[model samples]
Target: MPELPEVEYTARQLRALIVGAAIQEAHVFWTRTIGYPDWHDFCAEIVGRRIEGVRRRGKFLLLDLSGDFFLSIHRRMSGNLLLLSPGWQIDTSLRETDNAAWQTRGPTFLPPTATDVAYSRETSHCRVCFDLADGRRLLYTDPRKFGRMELWPCFSEAEALHGLGPEPLEDAFTVEHFAEELAKRKTVIKQVLLDQSVVAGVGNIYADEALFYAHIHPLRRANSLNASEIDALREGIISVLALGIEHGGTSFSDYRDLAGKAGNNFDHVRVFQQDGKPCVRCGTLIERRVIAQRSTHFCPTCQQLIAE
Candidate 1:
């Protein structure tokens, strides 16, 4: 999953590259990826529209068009918004036959073999590709077929964007707010962190990192947290998320930036995916277990449940 930092970084990059650019056409290879207004109506409304701005709500990317419409993208798991410049081909296999130099390269598109299942562009899982007026192509790739694209008439509180929680990076998400939200839940702290309504865009990666940093066991009940623990959690969430954005987001898995580049945050994560590795803080072996049916990682010694 792209999570908050990845989506935020992609939005910022999109704002710089495509804002004010007009869409000449849209080519959606997969119909299921379209979530609203029907594919026919969607393509009709999107073509010729100039992009106004790009923003992110939760994990969804919103492209504000010149008209009242804006496109929202949810990169469910393995989804990526990659750009293909005028002469660039995502599959570098073409480079093998041509003498043209590869101007820029970030991530590979087509797989190495047919058994890899990236068969062809028309049959490939690159769900949506938009032809921009500037001769650039915006590609939406998802091997798992979990990416979603929808055209909204307007940004309505009662419409498609409903049920979203406050962005942790925003100034409005104060320590009091995070603590209050935690106070209302009796589930394990890890589950509370994973809840999108509690705080939007947090997933398994940051949840584990935050809990590890706060020294709170992932299995600890949310309501069992004391004031100091809650305060520590609040700081942990904010600080970790801010650092993730600074590092351009974690890319240990399918995530890649606008240019198909892997982010450097994966190297900075202290707990998530570091299971069986020695903890940097206390040299304790980090452990991984399931909490709330999600893979949870932590340092058993540092994140002691006895605090409750």
Candidate 2:
């Protein structure tokens, strides 16, 4: 899943590319990708509307369109939004996948040969394509089919986001508020951080990185965190997320910017997938364990668990 920083960077790049671009038409290859108003209605309503602004809430990319409509996209697992420059046309032959499309195992749902051509030409998972008035085409590609697109008249009407927690990078997510939220849960701190209702936009990657930086074990009970630990945890979350945005995003797999480029943040990760490697802060080898059904990486020496 593309978490907060990935979505935020995507929104910023999209805002710069398509804020004033008008939607001339839409080509829906997969109807299930539309979350609201049915595919037909969604396509009908979105045409002719100029994108006024682009922003993000949690992991959802939001676009303010003409006539007060809002467009929201959630890249659940392996979705990416690609924007192609003018003079580019879809190659019809690229739409057909090889017979071994499903037999091969890879990071993206796209065929193994997908890397040979420009991203825009690969239509294996291009679920939705939008033709802009300026001749550029925006493609929403999702190999796993877990992503979704919703068109709402207003931001509040999107029921999918009704219960999300506050954005961690926003002023509303303070240490006091984070501690208060943690106090209400007895589960492990990592699970609490992953809970969308506790702090929006944080997923497995950021959660692991935050715990490593805060010197807290993922197995530690949420309520066991003291004031200083809580403060450190809050700062850890903010700093790691900011750094992720600074590097574009963590592209361990699948994730790509509008230009089909991978993010550079993966080089800066401390413990997300650093299992068996020596810890950056200490020489002890980092370990990986499954907590709350997610792969968690941490340093045993640096992040010892409290007996509580």
| Segments of candidate 2 deviating more than 4 angstroms | 91-117, 120-123, 155-160
lDDT of 2: 0.86
Best by lDDT: 2
Scored by TM-score, the top model is: 2
| Ten-residue region with minimum lDDT total, candidate 2 | 102-111
Question: Which runs in model 1 stand beyond 4 Å of their true positions?
Answer: 88-124, 155-158
lDDT of 1 by residue, 36-72 (tens): 9799888998999999999998888999988788889
Quote the lDDT for 247 in model 1: 98
